[model samples]
Structures are given as C-alpha cells and as structure tokens.
Target: MVRKCSVAGCNNTAGLHSFPADLKIRRQWLHALGLEDREFPPRAGVCKLHFTRDCFSNAMQVEMGFSSQLMLKSDAVPYANVTPPARTPRPQRRPGASTSSACIQLPLSRDVSCQTDPLETHTVGTQLSLKTLLPHFRSEGVQANVSCKDFGVGMSNADPLGLSSTPVKRPRLDLDEQLEDDALEHSSLEEALKGQDSTHDPASLDSSLKSADSSTPTHNSKKYIVYESCIMELFNVCPVCTRACDVRTQRLGTFLSVKQWCPRCTFTRHWNSQPVIGSVPSGNLHLSAAVYLSGASFILIEKVFKAMKLQLFRYETFQRHARAFIEPAVIHHWKATQDVNLQSLSQEEKVIVGGDMRADSPAHSAKYGSYATMDLRTNTVVDIQLVQSNEVGGSCHMEKEGLKRSLALLESRGINLDCIVTDRHPQVQKFLRERNITHYYDVWHMAKGISKKLEAISKQKDCEKLKKWMKSIINHIYWTAASSTSEPERIAKWTTILNHVRDVHTHEDPLYPKCEHVIRKTTDKSKWLQADTLAFYKLEKLLTKKRTLKDVAKLSPHHQTSSLEAFRAVILRFAPKNVVFPFIGMLCRLYLAAMHYNENVDRPLAETEEGVPLFKISFPKSRKEECRVKPQKTQPTFGYVADTMDLIFEKVFVNPVPYTDALLAIPVPEDLSP
Candidate 1:
C-alpha cells in the first residue's frame, strides 16, 4: 500500500527505507528533519530525499530519490556513517558455583585500556602529534550539531589530543525527514541547520499530535454547543465589577432563566426567565401597545416578533398576561378620569347629559352590554358600566340594568344633569321617571319613530307623496328644535309644519314664522314645499301623538347623543362585537375606548392642509327601504388611542397591581401563572 510519507508534509515515497531500528535514533532523525510529533503508518520508512549521493544502494533511490514503486524492508536502516551505542555482554557463570569454587573470566588490564601511564613515551596504536591528526580531521569535512546557546569558551579552546581544528560529524537525517523539512530549507545547496535532540517518543508521537489536532474543537465545544440550536454562555459575569471573579468567570453565560449578580459589586442583570429560547417578552413594551392598545391580534404579534428574532412567550401567554395587566389598570384610570371630568364639570350648574347602552351584539341577543354617560358640554365619558345576564339578579337583558348602573355611578360622582336624551325605550323612560331626572327624547330617535309611521302611511295609495315630504318632516323637526329655545316657541315652530307642508312657509310661530334659510329664486320653495293633502294629513297624524308632542316640548338639538354614538363606534373597534371578551376584559375595553374618546373629543376628526375642516360623506342607515340617501359631511379626528395606551402601560403597568379586578372576579389564567 502506498501510504503518505511519515515525514511532515512530504508525500513522495519512491525507494523508501525503514528508519533507524533503534527508536531513540529514529526520533532524533525525525526531529532533525523537523517532523517532531508527526504520526506515520506502521513500519513506515524514509524516502531517499534524506540521503546523500553515496548513501543509496539502488538505481531507483539514486534516480527518483523515492521508493514509490517498491515496499521498504522492515530491517532496512539509514545513516551508515553514525555508529550505534556499543556495549559488551556479561560473561556467563555456572548456577551451582559458590564464591570459593566459582569460575570467573578475566582479561589482561592493558587489553582495552585507554589510559596510558604518564611515564610511558609510546603507546601501542602509535603516538601521533596533534599537527598530523588535525590535518586528517580537517580534510574529512565532518560536522557536529552544536548550538550557540550551549557553546562556551571551553568548547572553542579544548581539544582532545590537540585536535582543535578537526571537523565534527553530524548524525545523518533519514531520507524521509530531510525531504519533509526541505520545503522549510531555503535551497538544495543550503546545508541543513542542526536541530536540538528530541526527547519525544516515536511510539507516543501519534497520540500527542492527535490530541493537539482535537484540542481546537474541544475548546470551542466547551464554549458553545450545537444541538438543535447554538447555546453560548453569555452575560453571566457583572460587567461593572467582576475582576476578582474574572479568572473563574472569564466567560459569562448567554441563555435562558439566567439572573446573575456580582458578589462583590452587587451588579445584576437577567436573561430569559423560562429556561427556553423564548420566554416572557420583558423588554418589548411595544408588543403590549400593539396587541392590547392598538387592538392588533395576538397571532400577528407572534409572527412579527418571531420575524424580528425576539424571544417571547406564545400568544396565548400574551393574551393572559396582557389582559390581566391591562384590565384593572384601565378600569383604575377610567375611574380617575371621572374625577377629572367632574372637576371640569364643576364650572357648570346643569350639564346636558346623554346616556346610551351599546350591546356586544344587537339588542336581542347580547352577551354583554356597556352603558356610558357622557357630558354633552365636554363630550367626555363621565361613567360607564358593563353587564351580563348573570349580573344584577339575572335581568336577562342589557339596557335596563346597564343604564341604571351607569346613572347610579354618575350620580355617586356628584354629576348634575340638566336633561337626559335617549332612544324611546320604555325601560329608559321608566328609569328616568323613577330617578325624577328630566328626560328629552333623542330627536333622531323620535324622527325615526315618525319616519316608521310615515313609511306605513306612504304605502297607502292616498299617501304616496308622503315619501317625498318624509325627509322634509324629519329635517323640519331638527330645524324647529334648533331654531327655537323654549317650550312655546318650539311648539309654535313645530305647528308651522302643518301649514308649511301645504306650501305655507309663512307661519304663525313668533320665533320662526317664516323660513330661516335662504329661498332660491331659480326654484321656488313653494314648488317643493307644496305638500299633497294626503301626505300632509299623514304627517300630521303621526306628528300629533302625545309622546311626539312631549318630545318637542323638551326639544334639545344639543342634547342629541351623536357624540355618544361616536363613543359607541370607538368602543366597537376596541371590543369588537364578534370577539367575545370576559366580563372584566369587556369592561376594561370599554374604559379604554372612553378614555381615548374623552382625550381628543374636541379635536376635529380631519383637517385640510390650510387648517380648514375636512369632512366625509356619511348617509344614515334607516329602516325605510326607499329613503333618500342624504350623505352628510363629518370631520374626522386622529386616533391616539394606541399611543395613549402606551402611556397607560408605562405609567400604570410600570408598577402593576398584584391583582386586577373591579366588581367582577378576575381570575388569573393558567398559562400566565405558569
């Protein structure tokens, strides 16, 4: 088999020869070739590159200088010039002989003696002068490996038998070792530099090299592990002051559930608390802002945070903790705002108050309903209450109990009401009467009631024109209320509709006897105002009802709950009906809506670049199948609800309450507790 050359980095193998049979000499030659601690295959040998011109015995070793085509002999050796260490064996003795009868071999004392008596003038080998011997050694071109650091003045001056000029012989490097180091040698003409004696064992050299090769991965593996993901030890030591422990804590850890502190400095920081790649998202406040405040779905939060490489608990955990943290705080803030709203209310003696209830679903089958009272003067939610069928002795309905509680909350807050406007729900009227609070019907509600009657009448063949006059009648009711202030003036203005519907805009009312708005000459008001007698009688029929007349008696255009309706719209966005929330969650969401509305209620919803008000066309949805679609322009406002929610989190959740609840029981969800 053609194995790679044992010499370091040398691949040539032609005419290879087994290295020194003595292991120590073999390692010395290997070290001289600069292949120290290199592992080679079994019985590996040197190529001819290490030998001089006269050392090889074959044409192949002489020509290609390698044993690439031939297997090396196991007993073959290099370095014919260097002699092995020589020692004579001990003479054998008979086992039975004691010292008295023992046979011992003895030799003449002069036979192997190197020492000659000082008085002797001649020696057996023939005494040679130093001058004669020194010339022979100098002409031999011998070299020895002598390093300068170990050289001393005695080495330069001292010579045995006065042979100071004699050349020293260096042990021959194996052909393999010389070629292995040949690349390191500058050129073929350059003599090899002598190397220090190698104490390394050829038998154990493989293990040491293997260990060195493996050490890199071992050290890197100690610092980090690669399983499903990388786990690096990080940030365990306190950066502020860890010098005393730095020797031991040279590498801080980066991983989950890690809270570290310096014993000496008391500096501390924390990592994941759940011992996983993902845990509570302690540092990302923006998640709360987007999820709870901005009404972003939790699934979206998960996708987004995961994309950003933010380690976070699952959305389910977020759902639990977020609701728990935000609900109570929102309620607390909602109550606090009541105080502020009431303080602002102190300036007015009698504030126009409008209370309305918005169900989670429509009125028939609502799981939850929130009733809120707003200050018409300030357009702020003063108080609100949420209810379910189970609450308040199982009323099995939303508006009655919810409105009662909302009113009771406002009353407890010492809010004074001038008049209340609401839909013509029988329960609401009864609630108002029981409390002896003044009640004015919502004009839109009354107008809706009149329009329902008009739809009934317009279906009759005699009252077909009532469909055209129907819009005029609705507009007339609001116009009359806005155009007149007191009961009699409102009465007189509303009565003018009988003549005005028959094309008599010139009326009997003192405050509004004639049309208050401009009358165009291109088209006569009389032409459009000339109401059919049948339509006139039809409108008059519905308009003359006692409830209808009573609503006009307390006409309050300013008391219309459009702002409350706007609040309801905002609440729908926050607590969307399709998404059922727990009782506390629903209430808190409502509170969040109320807080957002109150803060920016006065600001126009939209403005042009020139600061002029901009508006959107919105048509009212009505019960009439073929009603005129009169789209009205309404200004828009900036939604700062999410931004405000961020503030609430920073201020309120910064030091959160241990528990969050109001009248309802708020249970900690199982996921969050874990």
Candidate 2:
C-alpha cells in the first residue's frame, strides 16, 4: 500500500527511507499545522535532502534566525544525521560481565587474588563511573532505550525498531543501606524547612508589623474632631511669684470646662464661665472702628457675627463671653486718661465740660445711675462713675451728687471751667453758685420745665398742647433774655406773664400746687430774668405774639441736651438690656465701646476732609509728657438727674453707694444671663 507524502501538494508515495513507516505521531502534528501533502506536478517529487533544506529555510525566514532548524546527532552512528525511528535502543554493558564472539561470562577482579577473599570484597581505590559502564555494556551487546517511545509494548512491523527488550533486575537493598537512606532523606527535608524560615525571619517580621500598627491610627478609630477650628497650644508653666495678684485665668482643655488651678501663681483672673460659643469661626475676624464705636446692643453684636459669618451662638452665651473679652480693653483705655487734669489747661481755652446720668437696671449694687462728663468742645467723655443712693431722698439729691462728681472729675483732670449752662435744677444751681461759676440755663431744659408745669395742670392727653404752648413761651423768654437790648424790657415781660399765670391759677381748682406757687412768686430778681429793662418786655411780647417766631422758638434749640442724652445712649448700647451678671460686664462693654469710639475719631468721612465728627480732644504740644497732675474742682454745665443716691454717693462721699430697691423696681428687660 502507498501512503501519501506528509509534505503539502505531493502525489508521490512516501517511502520508508524518507519518512519511515512508523509515523503515526508525526502525521497528527502535520495535520494540526495544516501542513499535509498537496498535489505536486507529474515527475516533480522533492528528495528528502531538498525537502529538509526547504523546510529549514522557510522556518528560518519566518523567525529571522530566532530558533535554528539544524538537527544534531552522534557522529559514530548510522542514520545519525536523519530523524531516528522511535523505540530504537542504545547498546550497554552488564556489570562484571564481558561479551565476545566466542562467549559471554563474568570474570573475577585482580584484587581478589587471595583465595580467602570474600565474594563482596573489592579494591578500595577502584570505582566504576556511568560513562565507563555504558561503553563496556555496549561491547557486551546489551542495549539501553534512548527515546520515550521505547517503553511502549507494541512493535512496528514495517520498521525494524521496537522497545520489547527485557530489562534486567537490579540487586536488592540491604538493611543498613535502607536505614541510612531514610535518615539522609529526613535530615534533608528538615534542613530545607529550616532554611526557608531563616530566609524569612518570622520573629523580626512579626515585630515590625506590631511597631507599625502602634504608631498610626487604624481606619476605624474615633476622634472628637472640632470642625474648622484651630487651637493655640499653651504651656501651663509660669514664673514663680508668691505675692497674690489679680489676673484673669484661662484653661487649655479638651472640652470648654475649666477645672484645674495652679496654686503656685495664686493669680485669679475672671474666668470665662460660659459654655462653648459654637464652632470655631472659619475665617479671621477683622473688626473696624465703625463697628466698635457703635452701641453695644445685642442687635449690633449679632450684626458683627453676620458680617464675619461666624456660626450664631446662644444670645445669652454670646453676650456673656463677648463682654468678658471686650471689657478689660475698655477699662484699660478709660483709666489711661484719668491722669490728665483739666485745671492744667489754659483758662482762655476753658474746659467746657458737661455732666449727665442714666440708670442701669442690671447693676445690683448701684441705686443711682451711671454718671458721665464730657468736654463740650471736644465732645469726649472724660469721666464716668456709678453712684449709689437710697430710693428715698429724691432725684434732686442724685442730681446734686452727679453734678458734684462731674465737677470733681474735671478738677481731678486739672481742667478749668469758665462758665456752665444747665437746666434749672436747684442742686445744679447750688453747686454752680457755691463754686462761683458763671451759669446759664440750658434753653431746651428750661422749655421742658415750662411744659412739665403745664402738663401737671392738665390731663395726660392735653399735655401735648400744653407742652407745645409752653415751649413757645420758653423760647420767647430766652430770646428776650439773650437779645432784649435792655434789662428793663426783659424784666417787664418776664414779670407780666408770671403775674398773669399766678392770678389765673389761684381761683381755679388746681392740679399743680408747685406751679401755682412758682407763678405767684414771680420777680425780676430771679436769674431766669435777662434784665430789669423795659425794652426786654416789649420784645418778649412782640416775639411771643408772632405765629412764625412762636413756632420756631417752640421747637427751638432748647432741646439741645443731645450731649448728655448721647452719653445715656452709649451706656444702653454697650450694656444690653438682659444682662444679669451684677452689671459688671456692662461696665466693661461700656468702657471698651467708648475707647473704640475715640480711636475711630480720626477716620475720614465721605462728606468732609476734617474726618469724622467726634468728641473734641486736645493734647498738649509737649506730647512726650505723661499726664500726672491732680485735677482742679469745677462746676458742671448740664443738669444732673434729681435727688437720688447719685447725689449722696457722688457729691458727699465721692464713692459708689449700695443699690436701693427703688432703682431695682425700674424694669430693665434686656438683661441676658449667661
């Protein structure tokens, strides 16, 4: 039978000499690679050598000299240069046996020359190597299988190649050799395991992992993270000082609570006892003078928070803590000015100062209101005090004391006064006269006096009309007094109205006994009179009769007590309505707000180059000099609030008095407790 050529496209029968008859495995490879024989033209069969060269060249070209197609073979063997048939055997020699054309037999070695030598004995210097054994075995006609196919049982009939040769049995192992082999194998296995552990160093590895775990946080660790906040780390250590001194204390802690104390320093400052003011603000706070100078009302405070975008805090808590922070600065600034005395000022310059007072409800210790004095020209508040008085005496006593205190402050500052103008309060009058200071009544206050009297004479509703009419008369009276041209005219007009009011009120069922008494006692001798001149009377009547002048004068400049009222407004602003901490915080806020106001006086105003309108203050040319002189006594120009503890404490004792029930009874709604 003819089998097709394994090469592609050839019809010639494949001969045993080229591909060999036992090529079942080779055929499978060819088929899988799509390399089976194809039809070649008639008489166009390729010889084995040419076919091999072409295949080698094609493989070389495909891979560009990557793997060589050159086959290797032993030089001494026939067909060594060609692919050998499977199951071929290689020749080998048997132990202690030799083969020859005559016979095969085992031969005794030369070392066993002695007849007593045992069969197992051999010379110690002699050993057989595998290479020597192969050559000797080949000479004995014994062959070894070289290819994997030699182990198969089937034999190929077409090719004289097969691996059915019987394998000789090796010698059986002895007991000692078997035991030694087991020991060597166990030792080798143990050494291998130990070597692996040495390379890895499990102990050091475990320690390294443990140390690494300790230094860093695990993914699930919990932290009390304060959002958008920064904290300044401060050391608690301080220099030793045995002597006690007042100081405000603050603590560095995980939470806002203050607990520990350092007894060594013995320094206690006002502690911020309030709760946390919410989260830390995200950005830096930069407040302007305008904001500082504004009233310290809760509204303004809230506005400041809004401007900064700080998270809002509880209103009460915010007020408490904010006041604590701001108050000290205020007191520091105010106290700094106390050393400057007004008396040292030139008389020609005159420290034209005004005094005023208002009540603070949250303050527990002071019954009388807080007092303030300002230099009218400078508009700066020079001094302030809290006066205490019994609810008893009257507003009159409070006024007297406040005036005295205001004058004392000027004297302490060494400022000298030339003249004073105020409402006609008896206490203010007495104080001014005693000091021999020239005094003029505040026209606005005088107008109020008239209105107050008329109001007493009418119903609560009719007081508005009475107030309007009285203001007109007060304005005309002042005009007559200021510009009458003659004392007789001023006196005639003043007395004529006084007599008319007295006569009209005497017969009627009166509402105001004091008003009736005041009218009946009218005289040219009083200071309310400009002069005893006749022309004053005619001018007063003519001016009073005119509707335009009356209207103008009625609303006239008499109400210009804006300076004193401004002082009250400032206190209200800095001291919120709901504060409950004995009103001490209020004082602090007040002081700070005032200082802020003064500092901002130099700010440029849009309307003018002269800068903002502020209370006038002048420092001496010798700016290097520190103010240390004692102040001189002076009279205050503004009328003080009447007959309260302010008079006794401020005027008589020159100290703050204990609070009375009357002052406490006055409702103050804005006090916030922290």
> For each candidate, C-alpha RMSD in Å?
28.0, 36.6
lDDT of 2 by residue, 1-674 (tens): 44544344444454312332335643443344344445322232222322322232122211211111222111111121333222213345456544431121122322111123212322111111112212232211112321111111111121211112332132111111111133332353222112111133222222211112243211112323332222111113211222222222222122221111123322111111221111111010012112232433555657766786543434443343233222333343356444442433534356565666665553344344666665566556666665444532443366567677777766665566866555566667678878898665555555555555554543454223333345446655566455433334444434445433323433221222222235444464322423244333433454345442332322222223456665566566556555533445445455554454444333442332365433334454333354434232222211111111123212221211222222333334333322
Candidate 1 lowest-lDDT run of ten: 148-157
Candidate 1 structure quality by residue, lDDT tens digits, 507-599: 755666686657545454533433546656657767777777777877675668888988988887788888877666677778777877876
The lDDT per prediction is: 0.51, 0.36
For candidate 1, give the lDDT of residue 123: 19
Off by over 4 Å in 2: 1-325, 337-349, 361-368, 390-396, 452-471, 484-560, 576-583, 592-674
Q: C-alpha displacement of 436 in model 2, angstroms? A: 3.0
User: Model 1 residue 651 lDDT?
Assistant: 43
TM, every model: 0.52, 0.35
